[model samples]
Target: MSTATARSNLGNTIAAHAILITWTVIALFPVFVILINSLKTRKAIFREPLALPNAESFSLVGYQTVAKQGDFFLYFQNSMIVTVVSLTFILLFGAMAAFALSEYRFRGNSLMGLYLALGIMIPIRIGTVAILEMMVATGLVNTLTALILVYTAQGLPLAVFILSEFMRQVSEDLKNAGRIDGLSEYAIFFRLVLPLVRPAMATVAVFNMIPIWNDLWFPLILAPGEETKTLTLGSQVFIGQFVTDWNAVLSALSLAILPALVLYLIFSRQLIRGITSGAVK
Candidate 1:
């Protein structure tokens, strides 16, 4: 650590932070616009779309409509159930499979890893018709179970890919020590490996959370029932073919953005570390 070397490191750190800040602003600019306009009068929204709401312009019509028109609480509950349950399964099963792939030396292991990783390259929506038929055959259509199953399938590929990489990076000597200490395989996985990959788990959760929360495709196709409708689909009541309700739309979007934003904030540190884990070291 010479003076010049320390100064260079400090400069690089500042540059990285500046780039991240700029990207964050660019990414969130649309959300900011929608939030501001959601609080404005319909007329004010169009007249001053980019401007902040003033006394005369401020209105709660959008939120009022959201409250009155649909079972928003139900929709929110449905979304929460679907997202949380799906993430739970994705993390649990994905981690297990990843642990197996990374920790074991079995025949066709490389092929199995490649097979699972293929999901990352291929779009799941390509099999939408097949999935729908399977769901229908099992009578899971129009149920939250249908949404959970579909989302779990959609998220697992990336989870396995990411988690396996992190799992492979875990210390083999530590795992061997756990084995010699009379720890069962499951105990070692649950107590040792999973904790060490917490950052990777957080990364996978955050990556999968937004898409599941904001998704309209599967919900519309698989579970369009009033009781099963997610927040994204339920917001469609405010949307029309010819005449759209801008206020209600913006208000719904603003509401929808909150959970994802909060989750990201909670996992922001772990997510960054997971993404950058091996790059520096």
Candidate 2:
């Protein structure tokens, strides 16, 4: 290649990297501020908001206050329980429903698919009143089970929609071979189909699980009790009560953020892999 061409390519690469770095900083700056402020004393936080924690300014008082005032562990447990159970139900039922719609020709199959797909377009918040009323009537209000059920219902449509498309791409020959080997339809789905669609499921799970974990509305409305509070709701309530205390407020925000951040970092690779693998196939 000519030197001019090489220089032009190098300039473009540098410009691209500069833009990416700028965007990354914009995205992370808020979290960075919150985390750093959480570690500083109130005076230092107010005086030097952008400064990092130094020997003189460093303090754990906010975290100490948060730990003393809240059932952090219990709240964490509730969040985890609701997210995990809801994801499990969404994957299992969504996959089964998608597989049925994609692999078999039955009466009303198109209608069923349309009905399920409707949920993707409609926001679940529109049905909050009805969901709360039903939960109250069923005695599920204030229970983790209620959150799980609500999240599962909310997540199912998109899960089914995504999984169904992937299911349709599964080789018909492979399914027919399973049948020829005397495998039951259920066996074929559980053994062969499930494995084949694992990447799509992972993608769906990562996408849906974040919203479930960070949700505050359902938990606040339906399950605001001390035992049932999720980390998000708990942190909100805590921060509200201590809003005047900047350190405590920042600490609470940091606490709520770090788990989700860590989880995203952990599963981000799987999410990327799923997308790339599905694209390649």
Candidate 3:
């Protein structure tokens, strides 16, 4: 390559890196500000809002207030149960539906696929009244079960849509070989096909987990009780009650953000792998 051409390429690379770094800083600035403020005293927070918490300005009063007033462990437990259970159901049902749609030649298969896909565009909030009524009738109101059911329903469509695309790419020869070996369809799915599409499943689980963990609407409507409150709902309630107390509000928000951030950091590698693997295929 000519010197000028090499220089041009280097310039472009530099520009791209610069832009990415700028965007990263912009995105993380708010989180940095919130976290630092959470560690500072209210006076320091208001006075030097952007300053990091030094020894003189630092205080744990906000965390203490939160610990005293909020049952964070219970809220965390509720979130974990709801997220895990809902994700399990979403993955199981979505994988089954996706497998059926992708592998089988059945009547109205296209129509059924389209029907399921419709949920992707349509927001579930429209059916809140009906969902609430059903929950009430079933005596599930103000319970974790209600939240789990709702989240599973909300997540299943997108999960099925993503999984079905990946499932379709499974090798026909592999499936046939499984059948010839006396493997039942269920066995083929659980052993052969499911393992192959695990990356996609992980991607789906991570995608669905964010909404389920962060959702406030379903929890508020169906399971607003203290015992059933997810972290998101509990954080909101805590902040609202302590709105005047900036320290507690900041601490509550930091607590809320920390767990989700940690989870994403852990799963982000798999998420990127899933997307890239599909693209390569």
Candidate 4:
């Protein structure tokens, strides 16, 4: 409130902004470099790597080459289906479980929550041998269903944990009021609690979508067929096949980066808000 105090606070704020900006550039500089160079001729790229693209330097050759050489659109679709379907089930089932855990004070509740959360610390990749055998035994190999089931299982642990934490903070009075109104437990969840948990749901969706979208391991193990390969796995194979083609390589990397960047930009606020609100911890 005093003049000197206010000035000192202002100086601290300026220093914090400067530090944040510095780190932000450090994080984004490599991505910026790749995108700019991907649009330039190879000669121009090497000669003026730091320069903004101009008409003389601008070329769509990389994109053209990537599009021609790879079925990028189909790969994009496969990734979308797996990511979306897995996320939907994770959020729905995770929320229902979270609501029950938070609302009920039953015996062994804490242990149950911890048991489900075990999958969070333990990477699902450790069970790859069993998962693959199961898929093969069930004749689901090279099928999107294989990838979807695996990702859904992998994502559920963290989703339930985060949603349960937030669910605990919901006012008890609301649940009591719903019950007083003769609302069944199912109606309370569907009509009242679910609507109130949107912020937490957005938080979970953003967190889960990234790993599922970017995963290569499960897709490679479960569904490497041309029709079923997700974007990340397909990109790896495509780049391997066209390793000598710099333009296609850069373009393929860019194509992979775009969807993730878009999702981050859209959901970043809610994701950060969730962490600060202690939804996970």
Candidate 5:
């Protein structure tokens, strides 16, 4: 309100943005460098590392090599299927479990919530011994099913915890009104509660998607077979095999980055907008 106070606030805002921009540039510089050079020829890449790709220097040889040598489309499909299926399970099961914990105060409810949420702090990789044994015992070691199940287990705990917190803040009166309207508990969850918690759900979806899309561990450990390889795993293997081939490696990295960048751009506004909006409201 006072002139001095307003000026001080403005100065702080400027400093914050300066820091943020600086860090963002630092983070993005390598990615930009890799992507631009992926389009340039080998000589151009080394000679003009900081230069933009010109029409005369630009070439599509990297992309051609990647596509010709590998079944990129198949890997893309595998990733899409696994990500979608795993996310569906996480959202449905996580939301249902969260709803039960929030709406009903049954015995062991708090304890169970705490139990499940422990997975957030404890990396599931620590239990690789048991997970692999279980997968092997069940004959699912090299299957996409194995990857989906492991990711669901890995993602569910955090999903339930975040959604449960959001569910707790859902107005009790609306739930009561649904009960008074003769709706079953299941119907109430489907129509009343689920609709209200969608913002948090979007937040959870985006949160889970990035890790799953970018993951290398589960694919390598659980489903390393050629037939079951996800895009991330495929790209990694391809890059390693072609490490000395700068064009191929850079192109592979670019391809890997494209889908993730597109998805982030699409959902970023929604993920940030509603989660904070809900909290503020």
Candidate 6:
């Protein structure tokens, strides 16, 4: 019996890892194609899109074009600022709201949770006209702040929903013990509760980061100025009505993909742990 159980567990673990590896490859295959093709000459790109860059076909012209044609660095900077700041706000406020919803029992508690969850069901883009009007009225149009605020609102529902589930899993006794030690509510929340949910927070950050970084809609609508253009928006300059610069487009996409990839690698462990927290065991 013991031997059979051990074999089953081992098999399950192997299957899990295999599935993860397969999914990773599938998800990254397009990115790999883009990255490799970006290093080749335009003619090579058309001739052998899937082939690796040979000595003769290797070129840096695409990268050069990206550097010369637009403010690539500025666009990258704007994207970084918007993504980071928006994620911070989403995590901080969403965690706080989740904690309150999960830890406290009050009148309309369920209703409140339902209210927040509604944001996830409702498409934020439906209110684009209204949001644009509000931003215009507040003079936030063409500002990074507009993007940040919109993304924060856009991400909050999912963040709260996921974090609240994880927050409820935190040990109540642990929190009570902190209170007994004369810790303030804020102290217990920050020092005790938040640490236990770091994986969940990391998960939330990764989920929201990609959408915020890659989003072209809000940036194009609200902050289309040269100074505030995100990487996704700036990449559009390489495309034209009839003659698209495929080389520059690919190079810009490669550059845009790097930061998101780096961030995912950084938080990957926590993300996996958060996602599979209860599934395996």
Q: Best-fitting candidate, measured by lDDT?
A: 3
For 1-281, candidate 4 gives per-residue lDDT tens digits of: 69999999999999999999999999999999889888888778789888878999898898999888789999999999999999999999999999989999999999999999999999999999999999999999999999889988998899998888888878889999999999999999999889898988988998888889989888888899999989999899998998887777878889988988998898888889977877776
lDDT of 3 by residue, 122-235 (tens): 999999999999999999999999998888999888888999999999999999999999999999999999999988889899878988999989988899998899999999
RMSD of candidate 6 to the true fold? Answer: 4.7
What are the root-mean-square deviations of the candidates from the true structure over C-alphas? 4.6, 2.2, 2.3, 2.6, 2.9, 4.7
Q: Give the Å shift of residue 217 in candidate 1.
A: 1.3
Ranking by lDDT: 3, 2, 5, 4, 6, 1
lDDT of 1 by residue, 1-281 (tens): 69999999999999999999999999989989989999999999998799999999999998888788767789989999999999999999999999999999999999999999898878889999999999999999999999899889889989998899889999999999999999999999999999999888888987788899989899989999888999888877445421378888888877777766887788788767766765223
What lDDT score goes with residue 229 in model 6? 93
Worst 10 residues of 6 by lDDT: 235-244
Off by over 4 Å in 4: 1-19, 105-107
What does candidate 2's lDDT look like per residue over 1-281, in tens digits?
69999999999999999999999999999999999999999999999999999999999999999999977889999999999999999999999999999999999999999999899889899999999999899999889999998899999999998999999999999999999999999999999999999888889998898899989889999999888999999998998899898878998899999999899899989878866766323
TM-score of every prediction relative to native: 0.83, 0.93, 0.92, 0.91, 0.90, 0.83
The TM-score, computed over Cα atoms with residue i paired to residue i, of candidate 6 is 0.83
Worst 10 residues of 3 by lDDT: 272-281
| Strongest candidate by TM-score | 2
Candidate 1 TM-score to native: 0.83
| Candidate 6: Cα lDDT at 203 | 83
Q: For candidate 5, list the clashing residue pairs, or say none.
A: none
Off by over 4 Å in 5: 1-18, 273-281
> Weakest 10 consecutive residues, lDDT, candidate 4?
272-281
Full-model lDDT, candidate 6:
0.89
Candidate models: Cα lDDT each: 0.88, 0.92, 0.93, 0.90, 0.90, 0.89
Model 5 C-alpha lDDT versus the unseen true structure? 0.90
lDDT of 5 by residue, 1-281 (tens): 69999999999999999999999999999989988988999889888898989997798889999999877788899999999999999999999999999999899999999999999899989998889899999999889999899889989998998899899999999999989999999999999999999988888887788888888998999898988899999999999899998998889999988888889889989878756765323
